[model samples]
Target: MLLQHAGIRPHPDYRRLMRALRLHAASPRGELAPEVYPADVANFFRRRRIPVAIVREGNTNALRKILAQVRRAPVMALVRGPEWGNEDHWIVLIGEERGMLVYLDPWYRPTQRYRRRMTNPVFALRWRGSAFSLSRGQAQSVRRA
Candidate 1:
């Protein structure tokens, strides 16, 4: 993972982490965006012509609506890393199939610089119903070759 390779610790703040992830997405080559935040990600989606509907945080009613849309399409979760002090993390939740939570880990820019080459690739894993369970696994087998 770029995060791991970059040594950029995950932010504890879910909101901040999401923002960082969105910023990471702007650079396909793993460059960080000058300004990254939830709003940025939301705007990026909108500019790309992706439909976005903001829901109240932790709102069950809103969650249901979002989940319904996610089932029909891809849903990305901008969340905080377990160790992030207050920053949020960004994770894409494609769907629940075969008891797994498929997602993508976009590139991240860490404060520490490393000489090794790292490739940020999207993968899937079995959703264990917890943040920790969202492990990196092989890409969806269904993806085109």
Candidate 2:
């Protein structure tokens, strides 16, 4: 909920998950930034001894694996937003509710969701203990979190 970094949009789901992981963003001067880079996210998990896996676009096999993980715990995802359909956005997937993939999207009101079939997720971030092992393909990349 805090936009402490310049040139970054507020992403509620990202913030929520980061807080859940007990990680905080800090600026070069040790001030709160409330913004993080992709590398920073990876580093946080690494320091916490969590495992991370990355799935690229159109990887249905990996997508299926992530979906299974979501049944047990929250997962972070990057997808193309509906607005203008050009921007890639981040959201937290908090598992299924009544057959819908519940979204903690910052751009929408609370409790907003989409049908699982409607989403075209490009990337996924899953942590260990809550997720199964990622099946890495030539298109999939794995990061030790």
Candidate 3:
């Protein structure tokens, strides 16, 4: 999704990379256990020469700071409970709407087919907020500064 947003198409091995990332899964205990390490996200982009700045587990205030500094849309992915699907969800943060955060939701399934959404910084219980914003690009950058 990030690559696409940056106008770069993934070469066909993306599925292999997703498997390697081990994103979205269930534990024997049947809890929400997605291994979405921010560094992993960063590493993938780094390989493509796209610098990514990861925001640690944080709150709306932290997000505000990121929104102010990002050159590209930030990727927000959070882990939710069973009621909210018990899987980690990812959204591309666009900007602010009214007082809410506006984002591009890439999820589309029989259960969830939401796209182009807006939400409160914290829309209730489920949020393990981890985000990564692409930094300002230099001459040899992927986003073609």
Cα lDDT tens digits, model 1, 49-136, are 3334554455565445545655554555554533333355555555555544444555434444221121112121122111211112
Q: Between the candidate structures 1 and 3, which one is better when assessed by lDDT? A: 3
Cα lDDT tens digits for candidate 3, 54-123: 6655555765555564335655555465645777666666666666666655555536755444455453
Reference-based lDDT, each prediction: 0.40, 0.46, 0.56
**Each model's TM-score, in the order given?**
0.40, 0.45, 0.60
Q: Candidate 2 — which residues are off by over 4 angstroms?
A: 1-37, 53-60, 109-145
Candidate 2 residue-wise lDDT, 1-145, digit = tens: 1111111222236556566444565667888754434455555445543445654445567677667766655556655535415554556665666555664666665555332323323233321212222222212222223
Q: How well does candidate 3 score on lDDT at residue 24?
A: 46
Model 1: residues >4 Å from true position, as ranges?
1-35, 45-50, 58-60, 83-86, 98-100, 107-145
lDDT of candidate model 2 versus the reference = 0.46
Output the worst ten-in-a-row residue range by lDDT, candidate 3.
136-145
| TM-score of candidate 3 relative to the true fold | 0.60
